[model samples]
Target: MKKILYLFLIFLHFSCADAQTFDGSWKGEVNVSGQKLLLVFNLKKDSNANWVGTFESPMQTSLKFPINTIKTHEDSISMDVKAIGLSYTGYLDRDKDVMKGVMKQGNFESAMILVRSENEQSGLSRKQDVFPPYDYIEQDVSFQNAKGNASLAGTLTYPKGGGSFSAVILVNGSGQQNRDSEVFGHRPFKVLADHLSKNGFAVLRYDDRGIGGSKGEVNLATTIDFASDANAAVDFLSKQQMVKTGKIGIIGHSEGALIAEIVAAENDKVNYIALLSGPVLKGDSLLILQSYALGKVAGLSEPALEANKLNNRKLYDILLRDEPPKVLAESLEKELIRQNNGNALTSDMKVKLSPMLIPWFKTFLRIDPAYYLKQVKVPVFASFGGKDIQVPANENIYALQRLHLNTTDVTIKDYPNLNHLFQNAQTGKIEEYFENQESFNEQLMDDLTKWLKLKTK
Candidate 1:
């Protein structure tokens, strides 16, 4: 659930030079597997006269990634978002005043033409976004993850002038995120928190360590370590005046769902949990399945999908090893070559991979939610998106059939057209997330809250 290589939620930042006429925003649409995703580029010259730019998916307005380098020669421009293995080459057409380009990442390629556009954020007028005149009291809060030397920052909301309410903490999935668990301008956590707080439940959602106002590092931490943070949140919530002591719960998404299982099993403070698109399979298997599913959705050929599966399986095996970073890198490089027919690792390839050699990914590679789920004695609600390519429901939920929980208040629901982010989706592909206007699916939230009211009350 780390949202690494296979996940294509992208961001780009570059700039136009004084010599080039690329000082304005450019818009285009790229076709991936019969779906159209709008791509925007914002290029301007900074005070230093430096060419700077940014890429936006008005729909996936979650990232503003920094590019490695941008090179320009006359009307031609090239840049690389090395972090996501994305690169682009474009030439300006004077007559049309458009930038025609080709974007390449791994085995995928698409041609695009960008026309001038003034809109900075499009497809963001969502119906679910919360605004002024709240029925709940929202406040900034913080708590110590003493074990991790972290002071986590969060927003807590509850019904105004209410009794001690049943409380739930929102846990995030993969990738670094703020308190809202925002993805592509979609804040599922914020929307869920708003809805829950209005429904007479206290909700607390926080930034990940080393992200936002939180004062901790996630570089060296594992899932178990994050559970410590969640446990600390439970402790903080349990002591809050507005929270019912015996009614504390957690709502985890993706990787956070695994953390929820760990905390619910180990921490008595948690009375219930809600899992959104959580993985039931072991980490390794989940990642493998994720890759295959993503490939299939992208319309990869059978042979290509098979080759990618074999390649990722080998790389994951290397990650499962406990060797040092250097050793692991060497093994990973060798496997990469073998998987690619002896092709050497390019600099860009290494740049994209350097981040994966860390501890979080390694630990996640072997994490098994079932090991902790079996021990969870609290009330549980696990929901999956039928179209969720990241954590496919048919397979992951099927794995749950093998689980025999100790809690009788368990609830499991599947949304046929929802994606990993719980949005109403067309293809459930990652790229499709930004195109939709809905943040968290209304039906899923309604059902989940109904279940919470029953179990918590």
Candidate 2:
């Protein structure tokens, strides 16, 4: 379920000028499964002379966000992303013009170094991101998610000369994604939309309600709310003149794939659904698998891996309780301390466990995809990336295959070399996702469209 949409491993090193203050860009790299991922920290002094900054992994766009108020003592520096209970503590190596430390989150920590960034580039372009001379028609459109009080903005693409065609709504996975569903400069959604549009299938790729031109409040909403917006898109598509009646379907990736099932099962107008790198396991189960895979690749020792798993299972168990908010917070905090061998909860631990109390993470803990998948009484198509550590094909595909869906056309395929984003990958690590230039695989697009062509009106 990455953006699993949760874990972004940071192996950092601090590089900065030997200035009196930490007032510049810093960078580092952590090797995950033999892939290099770049990390950055941008620090500046506020009017109060307090140091504040943001943590960034340029390769993983979703990993960039502001850290908590930084506290420095003598030559020591510290910062935490309180929401996820992750923290960085370092001490200046003035002689070496660097800072050395560890990036800690959950039960894992990695050696960190920070150095001055020498004009690092942020925008990575892909070969398939080519513009103009398109053989299709593209239109900007918006629809009302009346129930959620939002407007869903998106691009509608279809064959230029096709009389009429079936329509498919593309849903984004985790994180705040636009219609392009871009990450690390890759616009797979745009590439996929164009491919489908040019191949006689109409594709509607939209911004998440609060993203891009769409309007809504995302902070308090969970997957259920997003499903409502998708249903609204279905309503809008059904009314389009070029769309065949009752021929609307949805194609979702990652968390979006789980969502597509929800919309399909509940919305009668949806004739079919296609899940691209979708997660079928329960949220907690998927996270467990994701953790093991990532830990293995990060070269975590066996004892450390097992300990982390034990902690996660305990955390999920605590999260699944339907107690009052106050009660849950106390219980969860206690569990965290106990998990830390009865030590008091650290500032980072408090920050990290805070997300577990939110609407989305809480809902994700116990919600089972089968509840919706079994209700989907329409054709289904699902594909997985053989190397997708986030939502590994072996785990999810097997889970999906075990389910006897309500419909018959339950087509599922696993591409041996693809990642969660459906790009051709070497190791399919986060590093690869940030480094690869291919937005999407052409061959997979063809296969997906070929399947979609038959499912459409």
Clashing pairs in 1: 14-52, 14-53, 15-51, 15-52, 15-53, 59-434, 60-184, 61-184
Name the 10 consecutive residues with the lowest summed lDDT in model 2: 7-16
CA lDDT scores, all candidates in order = 0.75, 0.75
State every prediction's TM-score relative to the real structure. 0.78, 0.77
Cα distance off (Å), candidate 1, residue 219: 2.0
Give per-residue CA lDDT, model 2, range 260-301, as digits (tens): 999998889999898988889998888877877766665556
Top candidate, metric lDDT: 1
Q: What is the lDDT of residue 31 in candidate 2?
A: 39
The per-residue C-alpha lDDT of model 1 at residue 21 equals 68
Relative to the unseen true structure, what is the C-alpha lDDT of residue 47 in candidate 1, on a scale of 0 to 100? 98
Off by over 4 Å in 2: 1-123
Q: Model 1 Cα RMSD, Å?
A: 9.8
